[model samples]
Target: MPEAIHIRPDAARPIDVAVGILMRPDGDVLLGQRPAGKPYAGYWEFPGGKVEPGEDIFVALQREFVEELGIEVLSGEPWCCVEHVYEHAHVRLYFYICRAWRGEPQSLEGQAFAWQGAFGVSPLLPATIPLLEWLDRVRYAQPS
Candidate 1:
């Protein structure tokens, strides 16, 4: 069996990461509402940024998380991935499940933060819908 798909050749810059904080203990996690004034603002998303050259992913993710969400992630493990192409940019999102953290989350930027339960939760960012769906599917399998 085959599924529908799209594929394109990589340009000079072919990848970018979607960094995420994965709060566990039964399907709970954080989401941030991007403040009005920037690209993709007013949408909700997991906090992270571009993966730069020569940066180890663990270090890059930690730095990006702190800068974007103001929380110190204690630990994480590789989870899932997604890649999307916008008109001007293309990126491959390497997602991770951040299991632990220090310092209460503060909106270093002006974004609003929420701790969302898996069921009946809506994604803050449209780009994040896929990740949210994936998160729910993974969390829902837990014995409740």
Candidate 2:
């Protein structure tokens, strides 16, 4: 007999999010602190937000960058996608590597943001930690 599949009665739908990692020429990347009154408040994360219905992921990424950082994304590409479940919601995050943008990143949402090479921030968001680890590993890899 086949094993029965057990599904949670209250399984939440995964919300699509577009995340932007702005990388400078010197290998530094941007990190932002979640503002008060939001989920995971004070936890550091990459800049991004939920993708609205019918919106293109790239369009969502550009919109989020401009809204959250006050910068115009000049060049970027999709890097990877990952799904995470938090106490509040399940999220499907689409990450993009933003290499060029216009204007300096500013905290427009009452959040703290910084360009970090060594990531000294405390309490990083759960989903962000793995990405940072992956980034470190990639940056440390020997060139073939």
Residue 84 local lDDT, model 1: 74
Q: Give the alpha carbon lDDT tens digit for every residue of 11-121 in model 2.
A: 667899999888887778899999999989999999989999999998998898888888999766777899998888889999888787999988888999888999999
**lDDT (CA) per prediction:** 0.72, 0.86
> Candidate 1: lDDT of 63?
89
Itemize residue pairs with steric clashes in candidate 1: 44-124, 44-125
Q: How far does residue 121 in candidate 2 sit from its true spot (Å)?
A: 0.4
How large an RMSD does model 1 have?
6.0
Best by lDDT: 2
Cα-based TM-score, every candidate: 0.78, 0.88
Candidate 1 runs further than 4 Å off: 1-12, 119-123, 140-144
Stretches of model 2 off by over 4 angstroms after superposition: 1-10, 137-144
